[model samples]
Target chain A: MTPSREQKLWMYEKMLVSRRFEEAIETIYLEGKKPVFNMAKGPIPGEMHLSNGQEPCAVGVCAHLEPSDVVTATHRPHHQAIAKGIDLKRMAAEIFGKATGLSGGRGGHMHLFDPAVNFACSGIIAQGMGPAVGAALSRKMQGKPGVAIAYIGEGAVNQGAFHEALNLAAVWKLPVVFVVEDNAWGISVSKAASTAVPENHVRAEAYGMPGHLVRDNDPYEIFATAGKAIAAARNGEGPSLIEIETMRLAGHFMGDAETYRPKGEKDGLTLRDPISRMRARLIADGDADEATLDRIEEAAQAEVDEAIAFARNSPDPDPADALTSVFV
Target chain B: MTNTNPARANERKLTIARAMAEATAQQMRLDPTVFVMGEDIGEFGGIYGNTRGLIAEFGAERVRDTPISETAFIGAAVGAAQDGMRPIVELMFVDFFGVCFDAIYNLMAKNTYFAGGSFRVPMVLMTSTGGGYSDGGQHSQCVYGTFAHLPGMKVVAPSNAYDAKGLMTAAIRDDNPVVFMYHKGLQGMGWLGTVPGATNHVPEESYTVEIGKAAIARPGKDVTIVSLGIGVHQALEAAKRVAEHGIDAEVVDLRSLVPLDRETIRASVAKTGRLIVVDEDYHSYGVSGEVIASVVEHDLSVLKAAPVRIAYPDVPIPFARVMEQFCLPNADKIVAAIETMLGRQTVGEPS
Candidate 1:
């Protein structure tokens, strides 16, 4: 199904917002890298996995989801969290390790959980799949209308939990959509070197589920595929798989040399930048003018800037409070 | 004998397995959100029969028989719990935890704390533990100590049919993730021989035995015998054997390992002035050592004699019955340990 002009614009804006939010995180992370020698001594402490060029997957898939729908994301989850409508201010505070953070400064960047939007991320590979399956099972048992989306990286497909979860979800006919974001690399290891199959969605057939592959950074294609899969799941037609092929424009983590890639492989990365391509397409298709596109970028930047300000002003969690929150 | 109140005539005798099933059924009836999922739990009524007759009552939807995917089902239980469902997922055997340890220790145990108190994994991971029938190293292990060593999980190993029902009820109602471990030998299954009082009189109605409380099984004034699960029965037998020698042993059943009832243990040790921790788990850095340390850490003056431990030696449980019995903590071992601690003649060549 072709997206309407308004839908295209909304997708464009969301992609832009995700990109800008990640960009802000990168800048803030760099600021903390003052004495380049020691990376640990920083305001945004701990490793930060930025979803720089993978914004289209989040924007496209989340655009079809309601706030009630549950989403489980991977380590690099800023883009998906933003697209899923997790409060940016609290998320920023969480990354900054402030008391006003989503997890009260306990969970850093790797473990962001916004229960308001039913979103959670895990640092472990393929770990989110089980939880997403559980959430889907819960929705099905409760006769709820919500479906769960589990976002995993291509590298995670090789994990046992991934296959186990898919099989369980299929056997149970749970309302869950497994979205595999094929960014081509798991940290330094390329997908070709890691995964046995050339494509990820094809493996979904092993579990007796319909699988679709969306090539390139096309948000429209993702939206179309995700919409159908999500609808099928919500209607109790069981789970489906959608694999979106994308690129990682940035290093695996902040300050990652990315020496594993060939020289100049990242030089032309911007050529396939999803945000830029969507912006250009929106303007060319007459869905949005250049001025409106520019306005969206500015608004996204403003929102990110406000989130940063809120995080900076937030208080650090007291040392004594560490004993709290261990239980209910 | 301590109290004059008459026992309720309605109290029915139940095996640990039946009591557990009744507790689960009662909880599932009380709360629509509560459900059971495990391997062969639906039509087969669980390998240990802890979930017998649940599928017939709750239907296949609630009493689900999951595929042999511990990581997936356990992780899914965590996810379901986070989404406001109280799931009771079984691991089939605690020994199989090695395959899905990450899901239990990492996500289920630490998620609530990691989420900064915003999320609660109100799930119960009920797994069968212990081995007396030569299940071997792979199938037999009371790994409650390993689970209790972790920070975020509440560990409960009920000794009798009564505590099994109460503890299972409490575990289901609890907001935190609970590891409800039931010994296969204590389930009172006809196929698997039960201990002396494994099939005790349990109340018909639903109730919760407080999670972090210890029950004095056989109160006395001499050495305090601290144990749990199958070890409780062994300790009681040892106490009776030693009572002929005028040794008044107080058997303390530590129902919950995490949030441990250290207060009761300390009080018992303070009164008895001697302690002997009998554990089926390994000897080094385990429950027995923890119990000894609790008394030492709190008040060293309470001990008139050095505390002792009767536990499995630091070795894998062998498959041979003779070897397994030698490695296992039994009444003979407990009695020997007590006799040795009291400077008396050791029995049965110091097992």
Candidate 2:
């Protein structure tokens, strides 16, 4: 079915918003305006799975979800949170470890949480799948059409819980959608190097479910595929897996050396970038024009700037709070 | 026709297994949401036969059984609990918890608070612990002490038929996750080591005792013997022998380990001025060590002698029957430890 021009324009704007928001964070990191203990910044040596090249996956999948539908994402979650309409200021505060953060400054970037928007973040490799399955089970038991979305990277497909949760979800016919944003690499290891079949969707066969492959950089394609899977789940067809192929257009983090990736793999993917492709599609298809695309970009940048300003001014979390949420 | 009912009631004597079965049945009947899931816990009953007849009464749906994957089923229990189901997960042996500690500690115990207390996981994990039938190290270790140390977890180790029935009921109803340890050594012992006619009876009616409260089984003056689970019976027997030596010994059975009855211990130590902790698990950092630390930190003046513990050596339980016997504390060992603590050099062995 052909989507309405308004719906196409809305998807383009959402994708643009996520891409610009992540770019803002990257810039903030480069300027040393990030967390003092951010090991991913400067010369410190850990990877931050930035949502640089894969913004469309979140924007596209989440475009169909209502505020009541829940989502759980991996460490790379800025794009997902923005797509879910979580307050940008609260998300920025959380990433900055400020008292006004979504988790009251308890959870950092990877552990972001905004229950009011039904988003639970996880730093654990594939642990987010459990909570995703849980929320989906809750929705089924409550007789609600609340689809639970688990946004994971290609790397998470290797986790044991990932496999166990998927099988259990199918057996129980939980209303969940597992979106594997296969941006070609799991950390420094390429998907081909890690798995015998490099095709993540094939594992769905083991779980007795349907798996789809899509062009991850094309927001329209991702939206159409995800909509079908999510609608099937909400309609009591159990769970579905969608593995979308995209490229990483930025270093894993602001200061990542990109040693293992081919020299131009990061910059080369810029040609078919999800956000820009969506904008071009919207204009060429007569849904929107150059001026409308420019306005969307300007608005997203302004919102990101405002979020940074709010984060910079927010208060640090109380030292006493360190012991508070540990038990509750 | 009514006279037969009263005569039948007088003839019914409850076994530990029967009491446990009744408790689980009563709780499941009271709350339709309560379900039992584990390995061989259905048509075959539990390995110990404590859950016999439940599958027939509750049907296959509520009394579901699973394959031998402790991690998956335990994870399922955690998942089910999050979705408002009261799941009584049986982990065949307490030692098997190692396979799924993350599901217990990281997930079930911390999920609610981590979600900012927006969720409550009500789960009861039942497992057999302790040794006597020579199940060896992997199968027989008493590991409830490990769970008691965790913040969000509640640990209960009930000693007798009555406490077993009450505490099992309590665990199912608890808002938080509880690890209920039923000692393999204590069950099916009938009424051995009891005074001549002292009844070991549990009423047909079901009930639940509050968690974290300690029950005083036998009261005395010379020394307070703090014990839990299977150790409670050993302490009781030792107290009897101490009475034969003309020294009254207090026996305090700690039914719940986490909300440990610190006040009761403090009060008992205050009266006796001495403590002998007979713990079944290993000695290092065991429950006995914590009890002694709490007592020494608070009421040192009450301690007439250095607080001593009769605990197993810090080693994996050996498989040999003789070795297992030497490794675990018994009634005679508790009596000797008590005698030594009070400086009454030889109480159990006649001079």
Q: Highest DockQ: give the candidate number.
A: 1
- Model 1 residue B108 distance off true place after TM-score fit, in angstroms: 1.0
TM-score between model 1 and native = 0.97
- Candidate 2 Cα misplacement greater than 4 A, ranges: A1-4, A27-49, A85-88, A138-145, A248-256, A302-312, A325-328, B1-32, B49-51, B187-206, B346-351
* Candidate 1, lDDT over the whole model: 0.90
Model 2 pairs in collision? none
Q: What is the per-residue lDDT of model 2 for residues B87-169, given as tens digits with 9 covering 90 to 100?
A: 88898888988777766787777765555454567889888888766777998898766888887778898777777788888
What digit string (tens of lDDT, one per residue) describes model 1 on residues B132-202?
79988988888778999998999999888888899999999999999999998898888989995778788
lDDT of each: 0.90, 0.77
lDDT of each residue in A1-328, candidate 2, tens digit only: 3456776777766677777777666666555425454564531124455787787787778888998898888788888888888888988877777777776666667766666777766676666676677667666654766888888888888877778778768877889899888888776888888877858889998999999998646677888889999889988999999998977776655566679988767676877777666766777788887888888778878888898889888887788876665433
lDDT of 1 at A28: 76
Which residue pairs show backbone clashes in model 1?
A: none
